[model samples]
Target: MATSTQSPLAQHWGYYLNGVEQAFNWPKTFILFYSSSTVQKSLFKSLFLNGVVFFGGLLILETFYNGPEHRILGCSYANITGFPMYIALLGINGKFFTPIAEKAFEKQAKAHPRTTPGSTNIVQSMASMIYTTIFYINCGIFAAVLRSLIPHAGPFLSFFMNCAIMAYYAFEYKWLYMGWTLEHRLTYLEEHWAYFLGFGTPITALTFFLTTLHSGAIFGILYPFYVIMATMATPKPATPYGQPLTSGKGTPTDLSAPNKVPIFFGVRKMNDLVISLAKMMGGVQVDSIVAEKQKMMKMD
Candidate 1:
């Protein structure tokens, strides 16, 4: 909120600003908005959305069979494709990081918006694109790392979970976020209970599939970090660091909302199956079935 260069993180996040785009000249910048229905309505447009066809084209060619040893963090693509649930969601999945983009845009606006309507409008539009690109790159690098780790996973679990994560996030963005922010504001803070139930649908489905598909390494292997990412995305509004203007920690602000939208909307969240899967692995299924079996045996 304050533009007077307060701390290190503020300094760090400044490179991604709009009026400063020429100063940042990232190979390309992506401008995005909340509406998925529209395409490139703002001054800045992210190429990430356009990559849907490229990934689809690759699916047609089936290039996964004979490509260079994807040294992606040391795992092979085969290992990643092993799980039926880990397919990367081309570029369309960038929705999860919109908060970060907004933060950067606001920061730039605070810093460089001139005292004229034309100048302010141009700065805001351009800043949005630059910030969007930075957020996508951040999500993508982590996602790529996630993809590399699952190279040894099965195709079914690998791609399905990936799709499920992306799909759930889509709901988080389009539904949950709208329900909470816009819908609640319109309804004046009284939200529907269905909103809460729907919050974790994709997550619930994902947990069910993971338990059925990848029994062994489900929880112990990959659930810790996934949980952390989910928490961060649904940050409390008091969240301080919008986007670091500098690198080191700056002042912590109550920037996030307590009921912020879950980040499954972002391309980053892998899934929310950890706790449920953990419970299932603890043998709850056997306990429930034991009662059913007892009833049948009594009849016999």
Candidate 2:
């Protein structure tokens, strides 16, 4: 008797199971990620500085101002609370967390040295930095232009744009930590598109909604805890894509020695898409196009 093939959903039950497993393991993983003994000194130093700035500023605002309600004059207490949160998290991450993460990564690599030395991680880190920078710049410009064009739809547009940005902020740290290049990252996103959207969308929406609360000062103080949980919940990286070409029958080729992968770093498909778009737009002669529009307006 012939056996029936399982449905796609059944075939992919492992992904769902793994996701559940990760969820159950989250608290343990979070503690492990933060509890590294080597990071104590830098972590404490950052925490001390963050506390001084955040609390000291709040004290000054409360003392000299007309009243607690108008502590910062025109600015709401929420703004004071929120901005300091941003500074503390941003400062700590930049000053200590990143270096500590790198040190941990390096220690792991040294302990179990790669059989093949690959510069893919280095190239990926650089590409991720460039890609993130360009992405944020373009997102800001696009949002500004689009908001101007559709002022009536400002709230909806702002929320939509912010959701996309927040989603990236949630997972980009995991991508960086896992040493996945933009290409690998995109491919994993493609393959697990549904999972990623499900994971990130709710967090984005929740974060956006939290800013609208009247007691945002209290909520703002609690916001970083949500961020910490989101970071912890990020899944492990997908397996790296192997070299396309093979040296022998069904044998995957390894090019780690020469580091040829750096030449094709980042999301090449995205680059191609951008180039194609540029080419199409560039075909229009701007001066002549402007002249034609002017002539048509004059004729009308």
Q: Which candidate is the best by TM-score?
A: 2
lDDT of 2 by residue, 122-229 (tens): 323333343444445555455455456767896566555544444445444445556454445445554543334334445445555543332223223323333343
Off-target runs (Cα >4 Å) in candidate 2 are 1-6, 9-17, 20-24, 27-35, 42-73, 77-92, 103-131, 137-180, 198-206, 212-300
| lDDT scores in order | 0.32, 0.44
Can you give the TM-score per candidate against the true fold? 0.22, 0.45
**Which window of ten consecutive residues has the lowest lDDT sum in model 1?**
185-194
- How would you encode candidate 1's per-residue C-alpha lDDT over 1-300 as one tens digit per residue? 342334433332332121122212222222222332232331122222222333333343345553555535664453454332323422233443344333333433344453111211222233333333433444444444554565665443334334333323332322222223222221211121123223223344345344322321232122222222222222112223343343335744433223233332333222112223434676534444334323322311
Lowest summed lDDT over 10 consecutive residues: which window, candidate 2? 256-265
